[model samples]
Every structure is written in structure tokens, then in C-alpha cells.
Target chain A: MEWETVIGLETHAQLSTRSKIFSGASTAFGAAPNTQACAVDLALPGVLPVMNRGAVERALRFGLAVGATINARSVFARKNYFYPDLPKGYQISQYELPIVAGGSLRIVIGDREKIVHLTRAHLEEDAGKSLHEDFHGMSGIDLNRAGTPLLEIVSEPEMRSAEEAVAYAKALHALVRWIDICDGNMQEGSFRCDANVSVRPLGSDKLGTRCEIKNLNSFRFLERAIDFEVRRQIEVIEDGGHIVLETRLYDPDRDETRSMRSKEEAHDYRYFPDPDLPPLVVSEAWREAVRAALPELPAAMCERFINDYGVSEYDARLLISSRDFASYFEAAAQRLIELNPAQLGNEEEARRNYGLAIAKGMSGLLAAQLNRAELDIAHAPVSAAQFAVLHARMIQEVVTSKSAREILLALWESPQTDESAIDAIIEAKGLKQVGDADELGGIVDGVLAANARQVADYRSGKEKAFNSLVGQVMKATGGKANPKLVQEILKRKLEG
Target chain B: MIPYCADNFASIERMAISLVDVKRVAHLARLEIDPAEAEQACERLRGIFGLIEAMQAVPTDGVEPMAHAQEMALRLRADQVTEADGRELFQAIAPQVEDGLYLVPKVIE
Candidate 1:
């Protein structure tokens, strides 16, 4: 029987606020284990939680970005559970009515675009950590993360494959960072994903019982966990066994999932509306305030890159993947346009092709270097103006395309504030293009004297022999000869 | 036709509380209730439920359920960093502590 995989993700994104959601304690990571925990975070008796206005505003900003419905009134409910990390027996979270409702995120699957619909996003306080090692078989608890604000974004089960699930996650990760809501740092546990995966026969209306794979921190792991779970379900069904609904943990070392707890042992949260806190009421004016503060989102910027910048869909997506890269592209493109105003004339085709050239250099060449250096566009060694200068020189035939790569490497090794520094490297390394016709013509004469058999081959209609002769000419000049001028001079002398 | 609702008081009195129910509720709340005292605890809970039953007898038709006794506006605090971290003071009260972490019986990862 054919199988189809179904996936839904729940992501907990830590808000990038200065203080915890309810208390004024610092949310900075890696503080001495419990140093950041305050009375309110530790859930000391008689302490009331004052809602952090910054946390609420960040939620509103995210709602506006995704075009979700912002509920005017939402209630905070107590989710009761017992765990060592939970200082309060009950966690305060939104249950029936969340702040944001019914939005969709666009993810690229292969070459086609697909929308992963979101069920809801709610504001909640994160629990503290349970440190299990270095204690002689006893576990330790760190309450530093106890009151950190988190936006739990839940998605509908619209993803059909592990690949689709990963794409949706990557797009959402980029967006959270782009809007400055969360750092989207998986390493520090700022952003975490839980995937609900199930498998059923193809074209079946009923979804198979799902086992949630929890706390997958990296995208590669999320995909692997889902794929492994899907295969496990198919094998179980094939062996005449029913899948048990449970909560499982993905063991990255073993590359498989193991049952953490079965449904029968799951906690009955005994949810109730908390009496201490009143129902959260958001006014129209407040939503508008947050809307005014939001930056231009990634989807809109991606469309503009395609329409205004005239690049391919793939390249446009790549350029706008990060906010910094999009800004860098705009600055470099503007510089290129200013350097040559003639390209902006009535020839619209030429203008677009010229834009494509600049796009290729920025997205392909510069992006590769940034990835190798493990630096973001914000901290790249080569400034936008310097890159623009190097690109312009290559297009103007001042430096060969091969020399441009060398200059980029040199710039990365010893960076400068000015683009004119490239001129010094070119002169010192003798990479200046020898485009003078008189100088190149003398070298062509020396090549013709050495290879008479190759010259005979070209006269007899062997086109490859002519390329060999051209290679010799470039080799004699130490690859500094202008390729276009070399081709012209070589053709002229060979014919004579 | 005989107005059976008039005898609601008698029906409330007949409602029974069992020791088993008491034990289950205590276990769910993570309390270790002794079996010897389960009967007394059950009787006390029944008294509380009896009062709720009497209140339930009151006709609440056309009345909306209220979450709180009095309607009050929620107070909002400004989003600002106002508290200095007091990590040591908080950790000092834990049962056991090592390297700023609160130690407890080991749990599976």
C-alpha cells in the first residue's frame, strides 16, 4: 500500500525582550544557572505577575506580520502539571482563544510555492531547565529560563512530506529573525520545534494516530525525525500491529525516536481560567501601534526583488532570505546603476540583463564567500561598496573575471574601507589587464612561430586547434592579457 | 404533574460520597492521604458538595455564568526593565544547590 506522510509543527520562539514576560528579570542566556530567577519567576507565594507590555506588543507585531486575526479579548488559563522545572504547579497560557488566529506562511517546495496554514499563535511563559549531568546521579534545575516569554506558533497539518515540513520551518525561522521578534537561535534553545507526524494510505480521509516527536532543535534533525517516524509507522502497520499514540523524543545520536510517555500516562492538565490575571483585552489602537512598528516582511520584500530587481525567482528568494542580505543587494544594485546611467536608457531589456548581472554577483559570488567565512552579510569582511567596485571593474574589462576572485580573497584576508584599495592589489600582483592592442599583437606573433602544426590544423577547419593557440597566447602573458583582445589579435594574425 | 422539584432538598441529602473518590482525588493532587482518614475526608468533601447542590437548586435560568464575582479592568504594566536579577537569593532557599542549580532526585532525560 502507498503511504502518505502528514506533519504539523509547533514552534516555541523566545521573544527578544529585555525582561521576562511576567517579571522584570533579565532574559539573558547563560547567566549563572539561577541568577536571573526572581521572586515572581520562582513563583513565591503572594507575588502577582504583571503582564509585560513588551511581550504583548511583540505578539501583536507577529500577528500583523502574518495577517492573522487579533482577538480583542483573550483569556489566560492555568495549565496544571507537575515537573521539577515548573516552579508554579500551573503554567499560565492561552488556551481556547489565542491572541493570533488563522494566518498562513508561504514556503517554497521545490520550484512551486505552497502555503502552510497556521492554526494559532499564543503567548506563554517558558519553563525552567532540568540539568541532569554533573550531579552524581541527581538532577539540577535552572530557573533562569522560567519566565522567558515565548510565542507558541502552531500550524495546521497541511505539510505532506518531511521536505515540506523542513521548508516551512526554514521560512518561519527566517521570518522570526527578520522581524526581530526572536533571535531564531536553535543553539541557545531560543527557537524549538515539535513535529506531529503520522502516516496513512494514499488518498485516505482518516489521519493515522500520530506520535509527537518533541524538541527538535535543528532543521536537519526535524526532517530526520519525521522521516524516521513515518517509516516506523508504516512498518508497524505492515506487520499487523497498530501504532500506539505517544510522546516520543528524537535521539539524534541513535538517529531514531523512542517513546517518552504513552497517552495513558499523559498528564491531564486540569485547565482552568486563572483568577489572579484578568482577561487580556487588546484595543484597536494597540494593534495599530504594533503595526506601525513592524518592518517590511520577507514575503513582500521577496516579491519586490522579483518585480523591481528583475531577477529569477530562485535568486530573488535567495537574496531576500535575510533582511541584511536584501538591504545589501539594494545598496549594491543602486551603486551599479549609478556607475553606469547609460544602461537605464530606453533599452529596458538591457537594463534587466544588467540587473541580473549584478544579482548574480551579489547572490552567487558574495553569498558563497559569506557562507565559507561563517559570517552574515552584516559582518561580512567585504563592504557593499567595495564589492560593487570589484564587480564594476570586471564588467568594464579592467580586470579579468579570474582576477576578481583573487581580489575578493585578498580583500577578505586584509579588508579596507575604500574600494580604491583594490587598485593597489591589482598593480602589486600585476593583474592589470593588458588590453593595449599594440602590446598584445607582439605576443601573438611569438605564439604563431612556435606551433606551426596547430596553425595548419586551424587552417584545415579544426576549430579546437585555434582555441589551443589562444591558450598559448594567454599563458605567455601570465593570464593578464585581455581575453577579448587576445581573440581579436589571434584571429587577425592567423588569417594574415 | 405533582411538582417533583419541590423535593430537591431530599434528593440533595441522598447524594453519596465514597472513600474511593476521596482517595483518587487526593492521589491526583499528589497528596498522600492515609486510608484510615479517607472516610472523614470523604464526609467533609460531601458537605461542601451539598452546599454546591443547594446553590445549584436555585433557578439560574437566563443568567450568564460570571468568571469573577465583580467585573474589574485588568491593570497593564509598562514594558520596561525594572528588576535587578536576584538569582542567589532565590537559589539559596532550594533544598539542594550546586553551581547555581537546584538539585533534585534524578529524572530520565
Candidate 2:
């Protein structure tokens, strides 16, 4: 019998705040270990924890963006655990009440759409790092990462495959970056995911034992880890064995997961409300203010791109994959329409005309030239207006699209050059399409005369000879001949 | 439901978890558990399990299980940088340091 895999993800996004979550300590990365730790970070006696308003505000932004319910009041709880990394015996986290709850993220895997329901997003302080190498075999603690604000977004077990799980993680990653709440840098541990995976019999309603995979910092690792865990669990159950509930670590080098420890139940932590900090309460006005401040989320932006731009779903999705890229496309489209008033005769017409131009030309330029050159849209050598001018020239049949691409690159290299300068460069380079029927006719006639046997083959119904004739004409004209017009004239001449 | 007390707990279940298991778990967690502490922990865990048995008696029909105690949403803030504390505060906690980084004992051979 086949088995079905059920997966859930717990993502930890480190809020891009300037200071640590509970104290006014710097939250910068790559600082000398312990350099960013404050008295509060060390949990020293008499140091009271003060919640960073910036941290709270970032959490609110995520809540608003995901359309999660925002709790007017939430409490911090002490999760009691003893470890070298945790200076404070108890980690300050939300238990009974979280800041956000019950939101869903939609991710597209292949042609199917999967919605992962969010269980909750809570505010927590991160633990420090322990270095085992430097202390002559003794472990040393680095408190630099301690007290960093983390928004742990937990998802319900809704994913059925590793592909869907990764898509969900990536979507959330993009969302955080889009809202500017997190840098979404997995390498620096700015964003990380924990996967809980289990396999149940194909038709079973009950879930089998699940193992929690911890510290999967990359999307590739998350996929590999889950794939390994699912197969392992299936084998274990097939051998008349049971899976032990445990926390596992994925070793990417070995491409395997090993048991970290038996999973801890909540009762093990002996959780209780933290007495040091008061309960957090927010007013309706504050929620509204945060809601109002939310930028267009990826889902809404993608839908709007399709509806307003008249672009295909695939193109719209790609265009809105990143907020920066989406804004760049919008700016280019708006400027192009503005410069050519005929294209902006109405809202619908403006969208169709500009959107088609962007989909065909601007997208290619942005992705192939600007992004490949490691330049942002603002830093691009060619502005939207200049691109519009180039596209307009192409639309008016002054230059072919092929030639326009070359002109775009030339303009991109020299932003200060005007359209006439670009046209002059094209002309000087002999890149203009040979649209002159008379000139193209002469070249076609010479090709037919030079290759009588090939021309006879075409006359006898071998149409492939026609392309060679077109190539010869284009070569003779230095690729300046309009290929479409040449093809029409050649087919008329050859067929007759 | 019987109230929790060390004296009233069942005795056979108390010894079910071997001393070796406790030591192994503690070792894996990198915790130094003395023999006396292990015995004490076993007794406490037994009593805790006795308390848990009382929960099984309460009927849960028509009751929605809650992962969290309250049904509420989290508040969020705008994505703006607003703080300027520096690394001096964290550096003070290191046992040793160099070049603004935490220094640890050498381990590689």
C-alpha cells in the first residue's frame, strides 16, 4: 500500500530591527561574539526586560499582511530550559496567546495551488551561539545573537509533498522580504525553517508518528530532509516498527538526518506567564494604523498584475515575484504610456498597450541586461523613458525588435545618449533592418541565380530551400533586411 | 481526580524508567546529572505522571482542543529601522574576545 506524507513547517524569521527584542542592544549580525549582548541579554540580576517597540511593530506588519487575527492583548511566557546557549534559564516566548493566528498562505506548486494554514505567529527572543572549538575543547558561548527578535510562524500539517512544503516556505520568505520586516537571508540565520514530517497509510485519517527536523536553513535542504524523513518513516512502519518522537538534525554533507533528541512536550517546559514583563495590549486604532501601512502583498499584487496589465498569469506571477521587480515594471509601464499619449487613450487600452510592450520587451531587458549586470532598476543605465523611446521606435517600424534589443543595450551602456544618438549608432553599425523591397528583391534574385539546383528543388515542393535563400539575402544585406517582409516577398517570388 | 502527592503515587511505575535511561538522556543533552539528582528526578516525574492520569478522567467530548489558551491575533509594526544601540553591550558578556568577536578555546587537532 502506498503511504501519504504530511508535512508542516515552523519558520523563524528574524525581524530586521536595529536592536534586540527585549533590550536596547544592537541586533547587527557578524559582530564579534558577545559584543551585541547587553545586561538584559545576559539576564543579569536587576535588569528588567523591555520589549522593543520596533520588534512589536514588525510582528504587526506580518500579521496584517497575512490577514491573521491580531490579538489585542498577548502575554509572554517563560519556557524553562537549561542550555549553554540560553543565558536566561527560561526563554521569553508567547504560549497561550500569540500576536497573530489563523492565516493561510497560498503557494503554487506546478499547476496546482496549495494553501497552508498558519497556526500562529509569536514573538520570541533568540538564544546565543556556543562555539566548541576555541576554548581548548571547552565550549564557549557567544551572546551576540541572543535576544534577537524572532517571529516564529507555525503552519498546520497541510502539505502532502516536499515540493509543496518548499513552495510554502519560499512564499513566506518572499512575503517577509516584500514587507521589509525581514531580510530573508537564510545564510545569516535571518530566516530558518523547521519541518515536521510524518507518513500515514494512503487512506488513513490518523497521522503516524512525526519527527521534527530542525535548523533547515536553506530551501534545498528542507526538500532533501523531508524526502529522507518520509522514506525513513515508511520503512520503519513497514518493518513492523514504530517511529520514536524525536528532534532530528539534517547533515547536508552526509545527506542524512540523525536523531538530535527525544521531542519535549509542552508539560516538560513547565510554562508560566513571565512576571518580568506586563501583558502586551494593542488598541483597535493601532491595528488599523498597521493595516493601513501594509504594502500590497504578493497575492494581491499578482492578481492586480493579471487584471490590470492584461499579462498572462505566468508572466504576472514572475513580474510580482519580488516587490522591487514589480515596482520596476510598473514604473516602466507608466512612463511608456505617459510618453506615448496615443497608447493611453483609456485605462483599458493603456494597460493592454503598455503591458504587451513590457511583457515582450521590458521584461527581457530587465531580466537579461539589468539584473544580470547586478544593477538595480534605479541604477540601470537606461531609464523607463529611454526604454519607452526605444520600444516606440520599434512599434513605428523604424527598427525591428531584434535591432531594438541591440539599441537598448547601447542605450543601457550610455544613459545620457538620446534617441537620435542611439539611431545614429544603429545606422553607423549597419544594424538597421533592410525593409526596402527593391534592395531585398535584388539580393533574393541573386540567391536564386547562384543556386539553380536549390531553386529547382524549391520549385518541385522542397520548401526548405526557401529559408536558405532568405539567409543568403539577409547575409548579403548585413542582417539589415526586414526578415518578415523579405519572407513575404521571397515566398511570392518563389511560388510564382 | 486524585490530588497530586508524592506519597500517594503508585510504586511499580516509579521504577519503570531505568537509571541508565536518565543518565543517557542527560548525557545527550550535555547536562551533568549526579546520581542523587537522577533518583530525585525519577521520583518527581512519577508524581507528575500520576497527576496526568487525572486528566484522562475528564470527558473531552464536544470540547475543542486548544494549542494556545486564547484566541487572538498578534499585533505588528511598520518595517522601519528605529534603534541605534551598538555592540559594546554584548561584548562585555564574553569570557574572552579579539577583534570584536568572541574568542573560544582551540579544539581542532
Candidate 3:
């Protein structure tokens, strides 16, 4: 039976602020258990919670970035629950009215863009950590993270499959980092997701019963958990069993989502507005300031790459994976044309190929080198201008693609930040390619005479023999001959 | 039907609270209540619920829910870590502590 999988993600992105959401305690990770937990963080007597301007600003920034409506007034509510980590016995969160409402995020899956509508994004305070191991019949509570600011972005049940769900999660992950709101780190519990998964019969208007899979921080785990839950739901329905509306935990080791809640233990968090803090009022002027200060989003930048560089949509998407990579590509492409206005003149097509060449290099050998060296593009020894210099040499046909790799390896080992370093390396290694047909005619003719039988085999319409003939010419030229020019010259002489 | 009503005080269908509810709520609040305490708590809560139901019958749908006594916007503070380390001083009052962590009864999921 065909089943339509439905998934909506509730992502909790920890705002990258120095202080806790409502307290003056440090929100930094990796501290002693309670060193950062101050009196306000622990909800000590006579201490009231104060709102952080940085956290509210981040929420405003996110609302603007996703094109959401920033509510003029939002309120904080207290979610009452019992946990050792929750020092105050109530977590301050937004209940009815959230800071951001009604936004859309565009996710690209296999070159098709799907807009996942966001229900709302609210600001709240995070709970502490509970370490159960090594404590005899007790859980050790670390209140260091008790009051950190978290922006919970909820999406509508618009996704149809696990792949689309993962794509949406990744796009949201990149977005929070792109807009500089959250650190987007998954390991230290920075950006995490809770997926509400269900499956209904295809083309059904009514929704199916959903089970919330909680605390999936990794992308692969999100995909797997949703898939496992979907399969389990389908199997249950097929076996004459009804789907239980409950919360589940995804066990990555076993690759299954186990039901974590029983009907008797269902949560009924008696929520009420927090009386300590007043309503948060976002003024018009403040919203406009946050909007003006917003960075260039990925989708808009992808469109810019396509329009400005004349690159395809595929290449455009690849270039804007991260902010650093996108900026580096733009700088390098623009610098390439600036460094060589005459050689790579204002011919629209030639300038366009510069973007393509840089992208190709980045996607190919340069990517491998950087990955092997374990260096991010920001810390990559090869600067954008230096990369432009290498491509400036290539676009002029001074060095072939084969020798280009050798020069790139040298640059990787010992970065040369100067403009003339490329030329110095080329000159020192004598790696210039012979693109002039007249200069390479003697070498091609000598190779053809030395390998007459192979030439005859090529004239008899054997394609492999033609390749061997080209190989001999390349061997004679010590592999410095431009492969494209060599192929063009060989085809021309063989026809003549 | 409302997922989360802004005004929690605006609605209760003369909410009937039994001794079971009192005990459950007491457990949730981490309050130890005896049988007499539970009976007294139920009677008092019933009276409060009756008064709340009278307020619930009055339709104030358009009226804004007042979260605080004051209507002023929340005061925003700068995102600075102004608090110094007082973990030892604070933990001195805890019932149990191991390696600077607050210990509680074991909670398993």
C-alpha cells in the first residue's frame, strides 16, 4: 500500500549570545557543572528574570530573514514540568503568541525547491543537563545551561517524505548559521530537532496520528528516525493495529524509534503566562533596524550567482553551500576578471566561464586537497586572490589543466600569498603548456612516424588507436601540451 | 478545543475537582498531602473553580489578556556575563553534591 509520510520539525536553535536568556550568567558550553549557573539561573529567591536584548535581537533577525511577521507584542509563559534539570520547576517559553509567525523556508531537494512553511518561531529559556551515569541512584544536575536562550522554530506539516524532511532540516540548519543567529553546532546540543512524524494513505485529506520523535540533533538520525517511524506506523496499520499518539525516542545504535510515553504518564504541562516579565513589545523602528542589518540569504545569493555569473542553477547551488564558501567564490571570480581585464575581456561568455572554472576547481581537486588537509575554506592557505591568479593563468592557456594540479599542490604545501607567486612557480617548474599548433606540429609528426602501425590503425577507424597516437605525442611533449589543443591539432592533421 | 488560551483564567466549565485530582496535583507540585489536607485542598479549590466559572461565563473574547499588572514592554538587558562564579557558595546549601553537581533522586526515562 502506498503511504504518504508527513513530517514537521520543531528545531531548537540556541541563540549565540554571551549571556543566558533571562540572567547574567554565561551561556558558554563546557564549564564546570554549576559555575555558570548564577542565582537568577537557579531561580533563587528574590531574583527576577530579565530579558536579554541580544536574544530578542536574534529572534527579530530570524523573523526578518525568513520573511516572518514579527509580532508587535509577544508574551512569555511558564511550562510547568518535573525534571531534575529544571531548577525552577517551570520553563519560561512562549505559548499562544510567538515572536515570529508565518514564514516560509525554501529547501532544495534534487534541484527542485520546496517551500516549507514555518508555523512560528518563539524565544525561550533552555533547561539544564542531567547526567545519570556514575551517580548512585541519583542524577547529577548541571545548571550551567539552565537559562540559555533558545529559539524554537516550528514548521507546519507540509513535508511529504523523509528525504524532503532531511532537506528541510539541512536548509534550516544552514539558514540559522547563515543569518548568524545560532552557532548551528549539533554536537554540543546547539541546534537540535524534534520531528513529528506520521503516515497517511496517499491522497487522503485527513491527517494520520503523529508521534513526536524527540531530540534528533544529527541529520542522518533525523532521516532514519522519520523513516523508521513511518515504516512502523505503516506496519502497525497493516497488521490491524492502531497508531498510538505518543512521544518516541530514536535509538541510533539500534536504528529504531521506541515509544517513550505511556497513556498513564502523558504530560499535561499546566502552562500559564510568566508574571515576572512583561509583554515583549517589538517596535517598528527596531524591526526595521534588524531588517536592514540582515545578511545576504542563501536563496537570494544563489539567484545572484546564477544571474551575475551566468552559471547554471546547479553550479549556483553548489557555490552557496556556506557563507564563507559563497563569499570566497564571489571574491575569487570577481578578482579573476579584475586581475586580467584584457585577456578575460568584457566578453560576457568568457567572464561567465571564469565562474565556471573557479567552481569546477573548487568542486574537484581543490576540494579534495582541502578535505585531506582538514582545513575549512576560511582557513584554507590558498586565498581567493591567489586562486584567481592560478585561474587567470589557466584562462590565458599559459598552463594546462594537468599541470594546474601540480601548481595547486605546491600552493597547498606552501601558500604563496603574493600575485606574482603563480608565475614564479610556473617559471621555476617550467610547467608551461604548448598551445601553439605550429610549435607542436613537429612533435605530433614525429610521434605519428615513430608509431606508423598505430597511425594506420587509427586511419582504419579504430578509436583506441587514435588515443594511443595522442598518447605518444603527449609523451614526446612531456605532457605539457594542452590536451584540448592536442586533440584539435591531432584531428586536423589526421584529416589532412 | 483551544490549544493554549492566553487567558487561562477565562475558561473552566465549573471544573469539578475530586480528591484524586487534589492528590495528583499535590504530587505534581511535589507537595506531601495527607487525607485531611487533600480533602481541605479539594474543598477550597472547588470554591475557587466556582468563582472562575462565573468569570468564564462572561464573554471577553476581544479583551486582551493581561499578563502583568503593568503594560510596559519588557526591559531588555545587554548580553553580558556579569555573574561571577559562586558555585561553591551556592552549593553549600544543597542537600547533596558530588563534584560540584547537584544530586537528586534518580530519574529514568
Candidate 4:
């Protein structure tokens, strides 16, 4: 009775280019319904869409980044469809052949890595938006988005579960942002996914009827929609009802999917090569230029982090998930190495320790402070240099790790303050660790005397009682007692 | 223009799709198709299938399947924000708009 879910994703990533793909109109978001619409976007009779060079280059950049075969020559086709939002009767898209093909995305699900093969990525123009009002019985169309550029990245049905599908989608999202081709803003419809899901008996060679779920803008919705659709299909088949192939829309509020329409085949669209535009021929030089312009992608950066920074795969993955975060870590690591040469005895250990500090301390502090301030990493008050200085101070044992964290908060509140100034504030606040063993011993002795019963229990082999004595000693010293020394002294006293 | 054999017609073997099939499909798509139109569409489809007999003569051996007429590359753009302002133009075309968004009818209960 076990059924396996098979999933494929078709993602439309709105290119981050400034202008519309074929028109000179602006591609900026949140414009008046028609203000950004140019004559071409309005589909005026005399107007013609001139391919934007920038949009083309962005597509090539994505192709190179994903290691797809950049088609030397590709053609645009007209997909004829009728909808109020479509200003023109037909939409210009790549159908018969797309720009890039046969690429693979590596995704990590749990501890295992899976490669999701990409079928193709094609360039297309976006349609206008339709508007309907409560009072108005009629609908309106906004042409601002009509000519915007989109790259539809289609994937093979290589995913088996909703988790794997989500993992693949997230990896693609990160890759797009990392390559600087797409903003990958799910909220703004900049990046969207349509999942094609089908379920068959486990290990069945025959494919089952598939349903396409549309308008999954966020990763959370992608996971939920797929999970619901899989179960729905399985139930339909179990009840002796054949699964129907159709397009469905995900209703996030209801947490269910409703049928949109029967799936349309290629013939239904009446696709034909667009006669207006000529074939797009990319020269070898052009492909090379795009390949050279690509920044270090996530995969390369992750490998480099492990090799150059000596970080673990998990830590490197976290750091390289975002380009900005990875850059921040690299900058901070560089500064720490420059400031504290004595702490890092050799080049290898220097990289290793620097990476470990960043993974454990710096990342944690950044996450906590950013969350507290409700700010993104870009708007964080603490600069990379300040973070480096704080880590250097901690490594030098001038302040304990806990004290350094407090100093970091103070620095984040006041970015203009330097490491010395933060250290002065910590000193003024009397937050420095009590490193003197003699001082810690006296505090421990007082704690033992006050909790005689607990101390006796500790002496009688109750380890929990020993921890309580250490807590009292730390409290007696106002949490300034070096915890390592406090624990050593308390254990010695109790055991003795 | 392509001819087809009557024996190769899967629809005839599966079931005779009457006016009922057309009506159901049209209803699912929210199209108001008249009964007369549905009958005409069914007749047209049956007539179209009768012509498939011509395809059996065309040898599709070394003939490569043609998905598109021509093969070409798609042009790309530099990943930069180029467009500046557009709010006013978008608002002008909206039949109805609220604040900054295009208002849509509440489709859900």
C-alpha cells in the first residue's frame, strides 16, 4: 500500500534587470498599474519589442552558473492564449527550444546529497496583471509587468518527497541570488514555482497521472502544496478512481489545492515560431564573457571555505548560503588573523581556529543581535571589523567569551565605538571574568559553608549537588567568577 | 492534412465521446458552450481523426523529430536594476485599484 511521490518543479525567476525584456519600460516593482508600461508593453499596433541586451546577458549568466548547455541558437515562439491580463493575444516564449538545457542542481536532504536534473531554462516575457474590485463588476488589466523578463527553469521529476522538493527549490533560490541573476524574492512574485506531482505504487515502472500545482511563491507553500497533493492523489487512486491530469491552484489559507483546469498540451497553445523576432544566436565570445562574469557560486564558495578557512561542511554550508554572509565571515576572519598573530601559531591552525570562532561565536552573536533588532544582516549595527576586534580580544583572554558577547551588544548599539571603548564599558560595568584562582576559591568556600547539606551530598557522591554549589559560587561572585575555575575549586572542595 | 487509419483511433476503442464529454470539459473550464457548439466540436474532432491515414505513409526513419523550426540562442542582459519609476503609469490602466495594489474580487468564501 506504500505510494511514492514524484515531483518536478518549474520555476519562473524574474530577472533582476532594470528594464523590461523587450521594451525600454522600467522593470521596477510596485509601480502604478500602467505607469511603467511603454508603447510596446501596451501592445500598440505600431510598437515592436526590441530585445534588451541586458536581459539576454542575464540568461546566459544563469546558464553558465548552472553548467547548462547554452544553446548557440534559440528561437522565440508565440504561445496563443486568451486571458484579460494578456494584452497581446499571444505570449512570446521559448517552446520548441530553450536557451539552456541539461543542468543539475545538488541539494542536501538530511545527511544525503541528491542531484536534481534540470530539463531546460527558457527566456520569456511576463503578462500583465488583472484586477477586480468588490464594487466594480468589471476587471482591469495592468500592463506594467507585461514585458518583464523571466527565466523559466524546468526540472526533471527527480525528487521523491516534499522535503526533497523543498530542498531543491531552496538550493535553486540560493543559486539565483548568489549568481546575481535573480533577486529570488518570493514575496514579490520575483521568484515563483509550479510543482508537478504524481503518486504511483512504490517501485512502479509506469508513471501515474500528474497534477500541476501553480502559484507556489514561498518554500513553505511549496512543501505544503506537494504534501497535500500527494495524499490527495493516493486517496483518489485507492478509491478506484483514476487520477485526473490537471492544473491546480494552492489555497494557502485552506491548506488545499483546487483544480484550475484540465492540463493543456502543446497543441492546445497552438505554438509557432514568433515571426517578428529573429533567432537569437550567441557567439562563443558572448558565452565566455557571461561565464567569466559569474561570481563565485555557492558550490565553489562552500568548497573554498572548507579548503581555505578549514571549516566543516555544515558550517561552510551555512556561511555560504548567502553571498553577503559569506563575504562578512571572510572579512572578519581576515581581520582576526591580522590582529592576533600570536594566537594562531601556524597558517593551518590560524585558518582552523578563525573558522571555528566564526562558526561558533560570531555567527551566534550575529543571529541573536539581528533577531533582537529585527534587522537584516545588511542593516546590522556591528561591522565586520568590530566583530574581528572583539574575537581577537577574547582570544587574547583580555575578556571571557561571555564578557565579549556583552561587549558586542554594546558595540552593535553604538557602531562608532571602538574595541577599546567597548572594553572600557565592560570594565566600567564590572563584567570582566574573575580569572584569579585564589579569589574564586574564597567565593567557592563561602558557597560550601552556606549550603552545608548540599556540600555534604556532593561529598557523598551526588554530582547534581556539586553543580548547585558551583551555581551558588558563581552567583556569590555576581557571575564574574571564571566558570572553569569555579567548577574546579568547588569539585575539589566537595571531593576533599 | 495527415491521414489516419480507423483502427489506430484510440477514442473509438475507448468510448464514443458524445456531446456529454464536450459539455463536461467546457463546464470544467468555465466556458459557456452552447449545446449546438458542443455537437459541432465533437463532429469536427471525429472528422479530423479520420484524416490520420496519411501519416502512415510518411517514413519517419532518419527524419529527426522537429520540435521547433529553427535552433537559436536566447539573448541575455546584465543583472542590473535599470528601470526607475513606474507607479503612475500602472495606476492609469487599472479598472479598479486600492492604495497601491490592483484590487481583485474575493474568490474565496
| Number of the top lDDT candidate | 3
Ranking of all candidate structures by their lDDT, best first: 3, 1, 2, 4
lDDT winner between candidates 1 and 2: 1
* TM-score against truth, every candidate: 0.91, 0.81, 0.93, 0.81
What is the clash tally of candidate 2?
34
Tens-place lDDT per residue, model 1, B1-109, is: 1112324345556767688778866776788989778878988988987786778778966664443345764567776677786767776677888988889899774
Model 4 agreement with the true structure over A35-110: per-residue lDDT tens digits = 7876677676777667878777888988888889998877778887766666677899987668898889999998
Model 1, A1-496: lDDT tens digits are 9999999999999999989989988898888888788889889999999898888888888888888999987777788877889989889988776889989899998898898899999999999999888899899998889989999999999999999999999989998998899999999999999999999999998989999999999999999999899999999999999999899999999999999998663456756667887878899998998888888888888788788768988898888889998888878776766666334554455446556777898777888888899998899988877777777777778888778888889989998888787778888888888899999998998898899999999999999999999899989988888999999999988888
Candidate 1 positional error at A351, Å: 5.5
lDDT by residue (A1-496, candidate 3, tens digit) is 7899888899999999999999999988899789999998888899999999999999999999999999998989998888889888899999887899999999988968799999999999999999999988889999999999999999999999899989999999998998898999999999999999888999998899999999998999999999899999999999999998899999999999998985454477777778898899999999999899998889899988888778788778878888998999988888887776346556576568788778888878777888899988989888888888888888778887778888888888898778688888899998998888898988888887788898788888888998888888887877789888888888888889
Q: What's model 2's overall lDDT?
A: 0.79
Candidate 1, CAPRI quality class derived from DockQ: acceptable
A486: Cα error in model 1, Å: 1.7
Comparing 1 and 4 by DockQ, which wins? 1
Q: Model 2: how far is A375 from its true place, Å?
A: 6.0
